[model samples]
Target: MAHHFSPIKFDNKGNIRESVFSILRNAILDKKLEPGQRLVERNIAEQLGISRTPVREAIHKLELERLVTHIPRKGVVVTGFTKADIIEILVIRTSLEALICSIAASKIRPRELDRLELLAKQISDEHGKGNLKKSNQLNNKFHEIIYKTAESPRLYDFLNTLHEYITKFTEVAYSKPGRSEEVWLEHNEIIAALRNRDSLGAESAAKRHTENSSKAFLEMAF
Candidate 1:
């Protein structure tokens, strides 16, 4: 379900790309829209109450991102993952996350670490309350702080794409039995490594974290 944005900002017509991107991205990430679904430009425009121009542009952007494909004579459709696709995404994410951790471990400020701790607690609370959506958002925000702290724009962009691919698996994990608690414990360990400024510790923690999820996704998604 699309979470209604309270205090919605529609005044900036220039932000249509960002707005459309966010909406469509969330729809895909949250599985509100399934993979391989046809993306009709006019239907999307009508649904969002906008003109087709922005929707067409957004679809073009999605095509660039590999989340959608423009088929000859068939228009656009969501891109679905194959086993090989899953393997590629997981391997790339494992490498990028290790790099992020290595950078963040040295540069993490005390204040930023404090914020991450808070996010961990919030994710735990949200999971306890059976609010999977909020929990997922908090989880992503926590990792995003670590990613941003690395200060590599290209790495950030790559990680974001990796994140989008892995999210489906994480969503499945978060909803299944006992996975949230296990994920929480690992996340805490990651935060602790960053707090101590242990670069090796951070790298190891991140590698383990990604490895665990990768294994689960491989087994579960297959």
Candidate 2:
């Protein structure tokens, strides 16, 4: 994994620290950097063709996000979520997501509704063809549209923080037999409620989707 990163090229536009942080964060989320894997600052620095300072800084940021841990004498390692952590995050996410869907149902425009339908159909097609990654991307796009339509920037930010941890294992959830098809059907229900502009129905569907996702993640992760 240390040699996985190519040489870093600075575009001089984005902050180097942030670039490093994002790279490391995505690697962790993508499972390229597995839980409990030790992170060697020197090796990472060499691989990215950068100094250890920014890598150290990035590790600290990931630590704050609870994606990494600084173990005494053992150095830093990736952190894995406990079952309790998963439950707590899902419980909060389910409620907040429901509210977000309710808000989106009221504010989403007709064009956006049509786009949602298009995305939903695409996801179903992708899943049928066994393209889980494309399906997941579309699924994320579907929810992101709802979050954007909700028009609550702060709420979106908070929800994303919760998502960082759970998002990593979503592929595993979808890989479970029949899970992807179930999720595709569930997303259609949510889209249906949104198209009808039924705030209550949208909220209920969103709630159920999250609950089912929680079960799938737990079954896969634990």
Candidate 3:
């Protein structure tokens, strides 16, 4: 393998298999490992300075996640997101995000609303300064605050399953011209509804925001 994978650092508190899996998963999501590229367990283990068993286990986990696939003659290969996959994920996100925001509108505390306002302002400032990466991070924190305020652990866990894809899609969407500013405006709308404890209003705003995000991603990606 020509691509050099950073060696795995074994922290006392972390599981080896999980660490390996995370590293590989991030590489794939970040497009460092392109679609259809073959993965050799021995080479990866050697490059990461780890045992083959952990590498094998990590690949298996990735396969189960549909991030990689086992080919009869080609061994394991990266399975990058297809356009249909992206659409499906974004569609699901729109529904779930709207539901979460609706729940949060009713359940959110004053302190959480204050925090959301702070994050929203920071996100807008960063985007205005053309620091899109920072803006994206703050945007994530904005939604994270809402998710926490909703106090729905099961829903949060379900969303976590789509985390990687959502991250990728949002990053792409932010790269589109004018999208960041629109995102800032959309955030404000959601926050306004939350401040008033308007569940229906929050749901509508959240749905609009995600729908716009989906459109931006589609326009930019394909």
Alpha-carbon TM-score of each model against the true structure: 0.78, 0.82, 0.90
Better of 2 and 3 by lDDT: 3
lDDT for each residue of candidate 3 in 36-71, tens digit (9 for 90 to 100): 999899999998888899899999989987889988
lDDT for each candidate structure: 0.79, 0.84, 0.87
User: Which portions of model 1 miss their true places by more than 4 Å?
Assistant: 1-14, 25-38
Worst 10 residues of 3 by lDDT: 6-15
Clashes of 3: 0
**Greater-TM-score candidate between 2 and 3:** 3
- lDDT, model 1, position 6: 27
Q: Cα deviation in Å at residue 193, candidate 3? A: 1.4
Tens-place lDDT per residue, model 2, 110-211, is 889888889988988888889988888887888889999999999898888766555655666777778877887888899889988999999999999988
Give the Å shift of residue 17 in candidate 2: 3.0
- Reference-based lDDT, residue 76, model 3: 90
Report the error of model 2 at residue 36, Å: 5.2
Backbone clash numbers for all candidates listed: 0, 0, 0
Candidate 3: C-alpha lDDT: 0.87
Off by over 4 Å in 2: 1-4, 9-15, 29-38, 51-53, 71-75, 163-166
